[model samples]
Target: MFLFIRSLLKSPLAVGALVPSSPQLSRLIASQVCCGNSHVLEVGAGTGSITEALLNLGLPANRLFVIERDPSLVAHLYKRFPNIQVRCGDAEHAAAILCEEGISEVQTLISSLPISNLNGDNRIAILEGMMNALAVDGQLIQFTYTANCPFPAKRLGLHAERVGRVWMNIPPAVVWKFTRASYAL
Candidate 1:
């Protein structure tokens, strides 16, 4: 908790919150993932909060991969979730990270990163990498505290729907489940 707070204080834009995501929000995000063939990839997995929720929801640890940019948080995640893999890298470079980790595609990509705070290029790159890594029927689960789409789907020719909302969080949050352009709502 102290580590997360310190990171958040040091870099508000990067950390995006005064505290880690609420477990309820984490569980809500995890519940959106359905059983599938391809593996699951989680981005910005700070302190493994969302990872733990996914694991508790019966996701196979071996089939789950997490990427956290901060080396310190990555180290904490590694120590916390020893059975799971945690790669220290940027979400914009997800494709390369996955390829380096022997993952061609994923059935789901759940993200804890704050897209609203990232710059246009970084946001586009992250979304592009996610789209490239997901399967045909895959989903991208992203949560934001804002009322509307933080990463507007219309800009990317994609579609997003509110799958769940957690008012119990520090400032409340909404989980928007995004799908491919052709399959969007």
Candidate 2:
């Protein structure tokens, strides 16, 4: 908790939430990952709450990769999940980070980023980078505190679905899943 609060105080925009993700929200986000051997990537892993949930769901540490912009949070994640690959970087460079880690694509990309708060260019860059790192049939699972879709899914030629909502969270959150439009049917 101290780590989260400290990180939040240090960078409100990057940390985004007053508290780390609630267990309900974490599980809900982790549930989006399909049962498979394919790789998984998580961005904005603040204190690794969702990352813990993902591991609890049986995702191998070796196959799970995480990117956190805050150096402190990145260090925390490294100490918390030493086996998992945790990088300190921006989500806009997720594709490059994955490539450096020798991951061409992931089956699921989970983001805890504050997408709605970012400006147009940053939002597009981050989302596009995420999409690029995802497999053709992969899914991007994101949560927001708003009722609306976090990103302009249709405008970006992506199919979006409101998967679930976790009202038990601090400010409550809605989960949305996005996939390439052509893959939707």
Candidate 3:
């Protein structure tokens, strides 16, 4: 908890929320996860609360990869989930980061990034990369404190749907799922 608070205080923009993701919100996000071997990329894995939930929900550790911008948080994640692949990079460079690792595509993306804190360009790049890297039937799950959709999926030519609302979280959050605009499944 001290680590989370210190990181949050050091970088408000990167951390976004004042607290780490609650187990309730994490489980809510995991409930939408599709069971498969395709890689699951988690953006902004702050202290890895959601990562734990993902693993508990049956996602294999080898198939799970996470990117955390803060070096401190990255170290913490590494210590927490030693078997999981954890990267230290910004969400905007997620595509390139995965490409460097020879992973061209992923099946699911679970993000806890504070898109509301990002500027338009950065946010778009992050969202666009996530959309492009996703498999055709892939789902991008994001939880936001606001009631509205944070990602401009419609503007980005993707379909967005509200999958769940986690009222148990401290600030309360809604999960939004996104897929390609033409994807029917």
Best by TM-score: 2
Across 40-131, the per-residue lDDT of candidate 2 in tens digits comes to 99999989999999999888899899999989889899999999999999888898999997888898999999887888888888899899
For all predicted structures, in order, the TM-scores are 0.94, 0.97, 0.95
State the weakest 10-residue window (summed lDDT) of model 1.
150-159
lDDT of 1 by residue, 1-185 (tens): 97797778777899887678888998999988874767899999887789999999999889899999888898999899999888999887887889988888888899888888888888888788778888777889999888888776887777788887799898799899888878755
Which portions of model 1 show Cα errors greater than 4 Å? none
For model 2, the superposed segments whose C-alpha errors exceed 4 Å read none
Error of 1 at 118 (Å): 1.9
Residues 1-185 of candidate 3: C-alpha lDDT, one tens digit per residue: 89989998898887888888899999888778884678999999898999999999888899999998999899999999999999999777777888899888888888999888888888887888777767887888888888988877777778889888888886888889988889846
- Each candidate structure's count of clashing pairs: 0, 0, 0
Candidate 2 — worst ten consecutive residues by lDDT sum?
Answer: 29-38
Better of 1 and 2 by TM-score: 2
Order of candidate numbers by TM-score, starting with the best:
2, 3, 1
